[model samples]
Target: MSVIAILVLDGLPGHHLTTPGLVFGTAAREHPGVAYEVRLCAGPGPLGIGLPAPLPIAVPHGLEDLADADVVLVPGHDGPRAQPPPGVVDALRGAAARGARIGAVGTGVFTLAATGLLDGRRATTGWRHTEELARLHPRIEVDPAGSVVTDGPFLTSAGIFGGMDVCLRLLAQDHGERTAGETSRELLTPLLRHADRVQEDIDRERAGSAGIEPTLRWLKARLHLPLTPADIAAHAGISVSSLNRRFRARAGVSPPRYLLRLRLDRARELLLDTDEPVERVAALSGFTSAASLRRHFSRQTGTTPRAYRARHRPATSPAG
Candidate 1:
């Protein structure tokens, strides 16, 4: 069995941080039984400091679990926020030194990057944290804007809603695509060969509500067509003011701002997928012009539209 370890710490976004194991653990239980063993290591051993909560995982292992692991996974965390537990950094470094295949979700990349393991390598984290990740590790070539990026043995994802994608990628590699596709179906989440889920969400944000979810889904389905808050409120069967409050509460963003992200998402796909001129991609994605598209894309992604396309484009093409 290939041992996999997940570090659990204080204030971690429990859901995003834990998805990989649960999802991949499901794969382990399937018919034909793959030899993947998952464990949560508790430590500051062979290193520094002590472990944090959910004490003594019943895995019949300790920090020593990593010493024998084939792969190590770090899930997204909220804290010890930006910095990793000193113990985690040391352990990760040790694991890599021993040749463990490592992966992370969301800001977990920060922890991995801190080990100096990700230097000069491509990695990712939550879309919201892309800039911060890049700033902290410029040599890393951070792709927080994308769902999943593999830099040799270091695998990472724009975590949050992205751990599943990263795990599935690993699954595809360890098992085959049919196994991965089946796992994806069992997971009932979108399949992202590289960066699908996050990118799809970006694609979706355009047709979404300037208000809240589910209701926004209806609106996102119509981005190429013109619509407004009033139209949205009417469609969702709520007064404009009520809709605004609901959106803020549920999505923590205004309806229009959310819609803007969606439009930008679509614009990015066009930039990469089509030979469309920037101006044309702009128009197609509902931006006023190429200039408008570049401004927003750069602001959101920390790289210019063309630069982003060039860097992230499939291996087929040359420089953009």
Candidate 2:
């Protein structure tokens, strides 16, 4: 189970607070193996909202929760320029030091920038505030147009819906694209957006220019066979560590995770595009047996292959 702690500052937007909860909560509810304990934490007092005549609300936890969280989310507050309270900065810096994946949504990026962890890292805030973020924190590279920018453990999203995008990407990393897609469908949302297209373009440029594009293509062509990291390294004509480094630099995910997504994608294609039975699909997609395919497929997609095919593929052909 992953522990997600949302750090709420006084005057934080209510919508921002609930968005992550909705996303991660939905993922956990729909996927069997994915679990998350989400909590809201404020420092030393009742929570305060930015709304006119907002009432004080008590949060269930405090700064201590941030220390042990697997992921800590910071949401936009009402005042973009207001310096984060001393305790907030300290807790954020401490969380970053402890290697908790930290995310700042919208103008919340300002609060994160105040902690200096985002210094020298690629980040972005809401488009409207990007200029101020750049002007205020010259050390941080702010992309005014980026809907989401991830630099290692730190993630920043430009707008409110961008928060949803961040959550889906995190879900993909945790489970897989199929799970993320199902979660998105459950929410009546589309998983891919302009930011993802932009990211794909960036990934493509990086991979192609780095000369590993052919290696990736080759791996895709051969995903139905048993392959190892060492095999991939040899195919790329590089050491394992070098291959990992290049993949990390260009793709933002490890080679194995990338390949797994590829295999699952192929399986999905086969399930939807052909009438092959589950056993054949399993064999063709590199799973050792129908049970292996069923387990992984159900885990990643929240549906059996038969069900997925029934839903996505036509039940009958046109009469000739």
Candidate 3:
């Protein structure tokens, strides 16, 4: 059995403490001969002080347990900007030196960053803390796009549900894509959010803003049509320059890029949910042809449409 040590610090979020068990437990249950032992290692502090009120629980393990652990995970805490608890940094460094894979979830990246292991490595944290992480650790390359960033044995995630994504990725690495995908289905969660889902999240945040809500709705409705920046500008009753500015400000991309993301999202949905041929999927998703769809799809998702469908589509679904 692979031993996973969870280094629990003060102010640990509730979800961070449990996600590993949720994922690994399901994996072991589903796959014969696969086993994982998850241990919660308490940091230097009075335990349970940071958890939600009236739900304190005891953690029996301590930092020494990290020495033999195959994987060490540090969950996000409230005090990322502050120094880590006593001996935490040295313990983490020793674990890494001994060939243990170390990971940090959310603001926990800040804690891991304190050990200098992440220097000159690409990492990510919660989007809100990306700038702070960059400011504090100038040597660590902070990538805000990927929910989970892996450099060598050290992994960091954007936190919250991203914790699940990272854990699933670890599971995939440990076992295989089939095990990871089966575990994801059993847990009823996507292995990772597609790029379009990420863009939709940004759009949702901007949905309340009156400046771009109508245009976003209009764009989604006409995703299948051939559209240009001029068409989008006319729909929004603004000049092309104004449309570009608004899109950049609200959606964080140009109008054309935003539209492409919408089309990609639609294409993904069709590929997974329907048996539509590649040509038909392309036409319906506003790509000029199957070749065009394949090019853009590969650029964004790193796989051809047919391959993506074969990998992710349900077994019972008819092949297109």
lDDT of prediction 3: 0.83
lDDT digits (tens) for residues 76-148 of candidate 3: 8878889888989999999999988888999899999999999988788987888899999999988755467
True lDDT of residue 188, candidate 2: 53
TM-score of candidate 1 relative to the true fold:
0.55
Model 1 worst lDDT run, 10 consecutive residues: 48-57
Instruction: Work out candidate 2's RMSD over C-alphas.
Output: 12.0
lDDT of 1 by residue, 170-284 (tens): 7765765567777777777443444676756754674353435557787667766566889888888889898878776555456776677788878877766777677777777
User: How does model 2 score by TM-score?
Assistant: 0.59
The lDDT for every candidate, in the order shown, is 0.68, 0.78, 0.83
**For candidate 2, what is the lDDT?**
0.78
Q: Give the 10-residue window scoring lowest on summed lDDT in candidate 3.
A: 47-56
Clashing pairs in 3: none
Ranking by TM-score: 3, 2, 1
- Of the candidates shown, which would achieve the greatest lDDT relative to the real structure? 3
User: Model 2: per-residue lDDT, tens digit, 69-105?
Assistant: 9888888877767878658999998988888888888
lDDT accuracy of residue 268 in candidate 2: 85
